[model samples]
Target: MQITHLGHSCLLVEVAGRRVLLDPGTFSSFEGVEGLDAVLITHQHFDHLDPDRVPVLLERNPHAVVHADPESVRLLADKDIPARPTVDGEPFSFGDLTVTPVGAQHAVITEYVPRIANVGLVLRAPGEPSLFHPGDALDAEVPAVDLLAVPVSAPWCAVKETVEFVRRIAPTAVVPIHDGLLTDPGRGVYLHHITEFGRDGGVPVRDLRGAGAVTV
Candidate 1:
């Protein structure tokens, strides 16, 4: 399995000849990409939704299966894409991949009201270990994850919290995300937290913003 970081919390995972895009918004770098087998939306936030990109994506890959929260599913129904609505704890299969939705909460406190449901995806590929993508918050419990994508900032998260979350999950490796809001020269906060957490614990941390790759 291969994982490519496409900015922010967005990531493209390729496994078993299938491509799975996760939260391709909020500084997403997957602008002109094509041939996606599945798209997973964690929540309905604009940074996560990226309506402008979804339409084009659908046009490029009409057969691409989109799995998202109920609200996101409703929003994408108007498009020609083959979208599927998923609920927490629901497990479904797509080719050699099996996805299990896990509940999560967006930490933002706005009056707009998060009418959308938030969730994390647990993807298990044939012969490969299970991978977890905990979208926004780190308030969920997972068992035996080989690879874990964790958010390190925004609304509610710090270096301490990140380290604790990683230790609790006990994943084989951890990837830091949710830091694209900062400019190129303004990534001190996120970097500091990530570095501190890495130092505090023995867990290996990958810098998703860079060109490095993570293979599971």
Candidate 2:
């Protein structure tokens, strides 16, 4: 499988002969990104799914089907765009690629803010290692997978929990996500800790911020 980070949480993943794009939000850049077989949005947050930009992307790729969380689907319906609700334990198939959505709740930020639905994804294809992308939550139940996209920095995220999550999951490799809020220097500092954790846990940390299309 091959994955490319287009900034923030957006990932252009190629696996099982299919090209799937995940979370093209406000922080991510997908101006000319095309040939998408499918688009997976974990929630309705603008950072994860841009309200204005996503429709343009779907318009560009008319055949691409969008599978988003239930609320996100409803919001898209208001825009006259059709979308399927991706829920917990539900599996969606994209030819050879099978995506299983898990976890239905986003991480809590504060008591004042309402919690939203966030679905983590597990992608598996024949003879390929399963890839897990936990949208905006860390407490999601994740099974063993070869590659895991771990959120490194966010308002609700802390360095301790970040390292603990990685240490607990202990996936073969990890890719950093949800880091658009930080500057280059700040992002480097966060990645440094996560990288060291991955190294100590015997897991390789793969940061694909500037690097293009990496096979995992």
Q: What Cα-based lDDT does every candidate model obtain?
A: 0.76, 0.89
Model 2 Cα lDDT, one tens digit per residue, 74-165: 99999988999998998989999999999999898888999999998999999987888999988877778888898989888798888888
Segments of candidate 2 deviating more than 4 angstroms: 198-202
TM-score of 2: 0.96
Top lDDT hit: 2
Clashes found in each candidate (C-alpha, N, C closer than 3 A): 0, 0
Q: Any idea what lDDT model 2 has?
A: 0.89
Clashing pairs in 1: none
- List RMSD in Å for every model shown: 2.6, 1.3
Model 1 alpha-carbon drift over 4 Å, by segment: 78-82, 108-116, 183-192, 195-200, 212-214
TM-score of each: 0.86, 0.96
For model 1, how does the per-residue alpha-carbon lDDT over 1-216 read when each residue is reduced to its tens digit? 888888888888888778888997857777766788888998878777787788777677767888998777877776654468877888988788998988756654565755346788899977986789988767777768888887766655666777677778888777767876676656666556555564445666666566745675
Give the least accurate 10-residue stretch of model 1, judged by summed lDDT: 107-116
